[model samples]
Target: MSRRDAEDLEAAPDLIAEGARVLSGADIEGARFEAKIILAHILATKPSRVVINADPLAPDSISRFRELVSKRASRVPLQYVIGTHDFMGLMLACRPGVFVPRPETEVLVETVLGSLRPGRDRPTVADVGCGSGAIAVAIAHHLPGAAVHAVDISADAVRLTAENARRLGLAQSVRVYEGHLLDPLLAAGVADELDAIVANLPYIPSGEIDGLAPEISKHEPREALDGGPDGLMYFRKLVSQIEALPPRRRLVALEVGLGQARQVARLLQSGLECSAIEMRRDHGGIERIVLGFIDSQSH
Candidate 1:
């Protein structure tokens, strides 16, 4: 082994302590926690075990752990560094190009699931802009009878969604497609037959994107974050598209930014011909989800 690697292995505790100090200096919250997580990732063990064992690392593991700590210290998101995230009680694989699923978005999934009638068999649903397939896979996992079609504009997102579905054993139930919102569903011949449509589309205003944390503004995909000047660009387009399509009985659930729920609810009511609309809040009391329903026979 190289001289530096040999030295690092011998002083593993000192090395971990130093890594945590560096992260703390960079203002990274939970610096020690992140340090252990990075070390455990390299050691192929749990973070809890890492703390309890106090074992020295191998030369290679020390070197790799140092590299990851440095990356995290630079404000790289921990999820991206670890290459995974948890959403709706499901572990999802994440990558740089795809948007990481946030905890608030889970409310959107729950809203959609709650709207489903109990004991319904094989209800058809569509997920628009299905980044990382978090919502799509979670819906299919929780509602085994759901036939879910997930579509995304980015090929990377499409592939990631498919991968998550396959890993979660939802491949048979969730189909991932590459295209703009709703287009893939139309092509797949399920546009008019859908019982529900859910989307967590880009809702951050273009002007406000620059103010987001570096982990988001610099690392997350812009196409997944920018919602135009007023933060409703994609929502407006989606509502217009639904307006032009033939009417059908469908429940629509969308995740909107804070203070955007009322505006989005209005748009859905007028454009989608929804007869009833409801707003659901996240644990933070922020209105995060809007649900609209249209009767099967109503225009």
Candidate 2:
């Protein structure tokens, strides 16, 4: 066969067809896209370019492509191999064991940004359990005057978050620390000074961690997934800490497990009066974010 014929056989459509043969499951469509993305990255091109060129994959490229596809077939996340994910228009670094920043959490960042106005600025903000520094860096990048601090329990997570902040040129604006939810911030003397606290803490019930997608259950850290028996452990602790805060600090934004929105709202209302509650929906319309603000006078 001529080289042109080989190229025709290795075109985008042909590659996708080959991918379909290897991936058979409820998520086959996602698998196909993943395969294309990996192939495009390996070829140093865009997804659109892959469809246009359709050049035959070199023998070396084919072997590497198949290796990635096999992992995708087993539900391994593509972002880990690519080492980056797009969140709120930011290219965030991701790796094995570090929680991949999800699109749903972008709503939380939007809500936090919306709360801050041009002239009225909060002096400090704390991002609890800030995986990859998505929330903290976004906040610092957007609100130049506000002081941003992030804390995570896992040392690796803290390191990854710090790396991301530096990559995004937010290392000077945002501070990343290693400690439990509020420990690091409190130790640094910024706890009570925080005007807003945002957290995307682990909210998956311990029993259900095994049931999550392999991309998450197997690759991501368990400490970032398990949220205790009912998946409210982190929320409970967060609310407790909020109540402990001084009167000057009040607003808090949290990302909860799907279907746990109401329960999380109730937990917040138990201690602080909710002046406003906005539920930010994911692409599927599920409530993915829960924002609450305490009345200034009450606190």
Candidate 3:
């Protein structure tokens, strides 16, 4: 390591207090919470357990802890540094190229789940742009009979999604595919057979991407963030594809960017013969989810 890294490791604190102080000095918000988490990770213990036992750090462990702290202080995403993230109560493995699941996307999952029929067993669902398989895994986990087909354009995302599905014990129920949007599903002859579809596609305007926080603009993949010039390019493509599906009652749920919900809804209405269209707000009160149902008679 560098000279400064070695010195920091040598002088690393043993207790949580010192770690928190060091993180605070680095201007990391929620210093105490983050310190406890980092220490717990280095010690291979739970965060709750760390609170009950305040023990001195071993020299090796201290060095590892300091290194993790340094990475966090440098604005590496906490999830990427820790190697996992929580989504819908399930721990999902995260990596550099794959997109991280956000808390706001949970609402989209709920909307899709709520659209399920009461007596349907083994309903087929597709998660377009299934980054890291968060939505696919969560849906399969919650709805035991759901057969989830997850698609992503990025090979890295496809691999991560499969890994997460296997790790979560939903490998048998969630199928992973690599292709743009719903193309894989269509190619597999399941396009017209789907019961529901969900997507958390890229929706950030290309020009505005540079203005995003370093954690997002720098750390997250641009293909997963840039939604083209107006941020509606992918949405337009997705709506067109969904509209082409054969006449059937299928639920379609999507997560959109701020102020894009209305435009998305209009696009959906114009492109698809929707029996109903509903908008749901995220915790931040921003209209986030756009849901629509295509009735069988619309064919």
Candidate 4:
């Protein structure tokens, strides 16, 4: 078969099958299923609807679809290839190098939404290390009265988060800044007024990063995944930062890796960072979410 032969398949089923065959080499877990998803993206419809239509695709459309498949076959992430990821019901733009938000983190968002209590009519939230502003925008979208500040160290992350905020009509509610953790908020003169700091910082131990799927280890940003030698590097810094800051009812919510929740919980409770800590499990039954409330005066 010619290199371009698969692109010439006119019938939808034949075209999708050929695309699936191509995907099996590198991106294969379920190539046919993914092929249908690619079709859904091209048609701007649901995957289930891809086959029901079964309409003959135009040559240009087929070529475009196959090109996307080829990118996926090269082991590019599906979300990156599609250039969007559905997070908390919002389709946020995605790109190479920027870490993709996981669905499991939605439970972390829910944990924050249910637990955030600042005793004020309006609240301030800082989504530290906000990659694409997933948590920040979702919180601002749900809490129209909130002011969410999304801060990240990476310029690409900051730009992508800002773009997602603007696309979701949350530019006013969700502000994006390029800096590490809460420093941007402090510089913006609102650090002292913050009610919550939520983060899903890198927690994969250095030794384990290369062991992750190629889709993650090879394609995603390493700084967004590496957590130093022990995977507690960034978390420890964040806890210390909060502890050193002036005290208030500043809530902290974090997403932890498997088997690391207990140690992180201990880290939070060991100091003045968190007065009381709580853990919540994700759909995968992993202890994935942790939250803590800061005692106003350590009473």
Best candidate according to TM-score: 1
What are the Cα lDDT values of the candidates? Answer: 0.87, 0.80, 0.87, 0.85
> Candidate 4 — what's its lDDT?
0.85
Candidate 3, residues 151-265, lDDT tens digits: the string is 9999999999999999989999999999988898999998888888899999999999999878899999999999999999999999889888888878889899999999999
TM-score of candidate 1 to 2 decimals: 0.93
lDDT of 4 by residue, 191-265 (tens): 877888899999999999988888999999998999999999999998877876677877889999989999999
What are the per-residue Cα lDDT tens digits for candidate 1 across 1-299? 78977776666666667778989998998898888888777777778777633665787776787888989888888888888887977889998999999999888888888888664567898899999999999999988888999999999999999999999999999998999888878887888888888999999999999898888999999999999999999999988877766777778889999899999999999887788999999999998999988876653
RMSD to the hidden true structure, all candidates: 2.1, 3.3, 3.7, 3.3
Kindly report which residue stretches of model 2 are placed more than 4 angstroms away from their true locations once superposed: 1-14, 25-27, 52-57
Question: What is the Cα-based TM-score of model 3?
Answer: 0.92
TM-score of each: 0.93, 0.88, 0.92, 0.92
The CA lDDT at 156 in model 2 is 82
